[model samples]
Target: MKILLRPVGLTFFFLATHLLQSQASAPGGSNLLFYGVAALALIIFFFIVVSVADNFMVIESKQMGIKDSSTMGLFPNIREFFRGKKPGYLDTAHVYTLTKGYDIPMAGAPQDVIREPNVTRFAVTPPDYFGLRPIPKMLVEEGDVVKAGDPLFFDKNMPRIKFVAPVSGEVIGINRGLKRSISEVVILADKEQVSRTYTLPGREASREELVEFLLESGVWPAIRQRPYNRVADPDIEPRDIFVSTFDTAPLAPDLKLALRGRMDVFQAGIDVLRRLTPGLVYLGLDGRGEKDSPYSVTRGVEKRYFRGAHPAGNVGTQIHHIHPCGRGENTVWTLGVEDVLLFGELFQNGRFDTSRLVALSGDSFSEPCYVRTYAGANIGELIAGENVREHSRIISGDVLSGTKKSTDNYLSYFDNQITAIEEGDHAEVFGWLIPNSAKASVSPTVPVLSNDLHLTTRTNGEKRAFVVNNDYEQVLPMDIYMTQLMKSIIVNDLESMEGLGIYELVPEDVALCEFACVSKQPLQQLLRQGHDTMIAQG
Candidate 1:
């Protein structure tokens, strides 16, 4: 029966094609019988193709251990570019360090610990602390002793939002910042066991109900929308959603570790996001995740393999390839994999319960591993530096993209990694043109006699204008023109930036461009500037 059907299927497909072609060639006196037969054949052909594809479909599962060399790992790739080239500037690159007063004076003795003005009353007044898309109703007042993960406030506009407590302390403080007119709800945690479970709304949640749930629960504040980079408006429907698993910047977090035990939460978050958007959730997995994720089209999720150097793993590149945000028609909302858990927590309970796993790495560190910490939590408690290093620069994120954090400073909204590299006082000889083998870190174009990956993270060459043209293309796996888009952003060309798709990029995405940059320009600053300009204009 199967063999008989095979010939019938093929014959019908060809017949349909011929009929359509004949109609195109001879429009007048078209046969009604031919039209009916062609329609049937076309439908049958579609089913046959679908059936075969379903049977032969491959399912890729994301596993923990899979190590592959970088695109530069291929020898011919490196040699092909360096063929018959005298290794001088590429070998001895001249870069200018653009220090924009980020350099802070070293703390004299014990640095004063200043409580974050925002987190002061966060526990008692959770909703007041976080900015929701629409404002929420204040639940509790001052001096209310709240337990960890307990609801603080709910969004009045969409009441599902439930802001929760970060620590188990007391409600000791409450005050307002000068401008922004946002309330400051302080919560000191109780340190006692608080019941933290709620019945999750199953797959049957209606769009209106889900929006209400998020607002009342307080987690709605976490879902920020783009165009203006403001909190997402529940009233305004979005076109698609984006989530970046790993940050590929200089001192970015090890997202693989961050998501290690939280796979369930991550999946839960993805599941929730799938509800809000009409299109597919394009998972921008680095080459690693693309080969591993296991999801079919029925799941409404599509996976694309992003293989690049630094910014290659960025969400901007992912958006540019999978679902390019259009001008005034399509809007893409991007979130870090770490924060997605907060969305998942919304359904489980009215609490903000995700403490991210971040890493602190640079030339100044003797150890670099994942640290379990919460958003807006003080970093001084987790970092230990008195042993081997002194006078080192402590960066809040990756060295290239991160901000200069005070020793007394708590981590801010955009930090995933804390890098500590030494601000060495070693002076060099005519550093711009010298073979910086001992001090410089170059890519395929090594300095005169320097090719070592196992060296300290000190800048060997003088910071000139950014110039090294390493293998950015080899690592960047996006379809859009990266260099051109970057140029448009620099010039503040809003129309061009939008045409080139600026909505896909966050500051951390451009860190790799800074790391491999020969001109040594701060690419993050440029990206942030563009983001700010766009938001302001909007």
Candidate 2:
């Protein structure tokens, strides 16, 4: 009907205009006013009819699960382009071009070459995880001999989820922290590592069987749910599962190197994850670097290409764009690329292989490159003989959002990169007044000659008043008002936090915002407090 009406409307409009022109040319213009009024009325009626027909078409297309590309109007696709609404599930991949973000250009990105590090000591720290009890029930005692994948400890609250050892080793030490809280379970890895094997689930296995397998095999901790960024509950099925195939953090490892020769294992992992959720498994890919990459050809998942600066590779940011988590009872599971490989190893080899490629990067080291090691490897052994700068800070992950650690500390369970940068404790004379080209600044006052900058552990400025401005919004790519959300979280306003889309965020999502803030407010810490408050309320 819309197609037929187009020609009829055009015909009436032209006829009325021609009649009006003829009447005006006639002497005294007797019927000029009548023709003019008729032409004006016809124009208005034609637009109204077309608009109604367009609405009907849009509604019909939506009902039929079809994209609304056709309309009897001036511009059909302009509205959609401005709205930036793209379907998460489609035959072809969806591209998300995020413009609101800042990529910190830091020196010391790892080389493509992978090296085997001599990391013998490994430890499983319960405090590394969020919401876990400070004193978890220990499954192994000191001097106990256990194989890789053996249960080290279990949270008293969630006894089903077991935290396992990364390698065959003996329990060397069980260290405690403030208030005698269990800090680290140190292990001395044996030369010949052995693994505990289990029966692989069948292809026709039920969801319960798969969940039970994951829980018992100690791989459940890899799957963390948002809204609190804690371990996923075994009983409640998530609405969707998300995985980011790349990392965009400063001095972060190239994930393509990690995925090398592990394509089959990665696919098997994706297959296992598909059974855990009824919704689509979303894979966020790097739009700038995924061309000809192995992850591009990955099957059985919805691929979303993200292009932008830092935090573009963050899974939380991707989740916000694709399918945001709602305030209450909307759970979304997220995992890293390495976590998926562990799942594949469990199903294929019948053992939880925690082997991963850790990138040793930053300007502190003489030669930065990739290191092949297991999870929770000792920081000292990983970079034992490397030439490192004096008075340097060692971080268990990337500089941004990574935990600070000493040489004696072990890597975080979820970290795949270790960063070392110079400490910024020394005082600088006239540093605030002088503009140094060597320093990298988001502000135009300090000249940044190149994107690759040599940064230190310096805040540059101290915390002062929390001014209301667009500084956070300039770096945060999501739709949430970052400044307002931070303020709400500060006052412990639960109602305002939920309404501001706090459920859709984790600490890493706002790490860039914290970095870009002129006030230097600890946004990540503040966000964690908000999460704790929300969890306590329930």
Which one wins on TM-score? 2
lDDT of 2 at 426: 90
Please write out the lDDT profile of model 1 over residues 241-295, one tens digit for every residue: 8776655554455566555555666777878888887766766654433233222
- lDDT of candidate 1 at residue 169, scale 0 to 100: 56
Q: Which residue segments of model 1 deviate by more than 4 Å?
A: 1-144, 147-164, 171-202, 227-230, 289-300, 348-351, 385-388, 424-426, 438-443, 447-492, 516-520
Please list the residue runs of candidate 2 whose C-alpha ends up more than 4 Å from where it truly belongs after superposition: 1-92, 327-329
TM-score of 2: 0.85
Quantify how close model 2 is to the true structure by its C-alpha RMSD in Å: 6.9
For residues 228-282, write the lDDT of model 2, one tens digit per residue: 8898889988899999998999998888887878899999999999999988899
TM-score list, all predictions: 0.62, 0.85
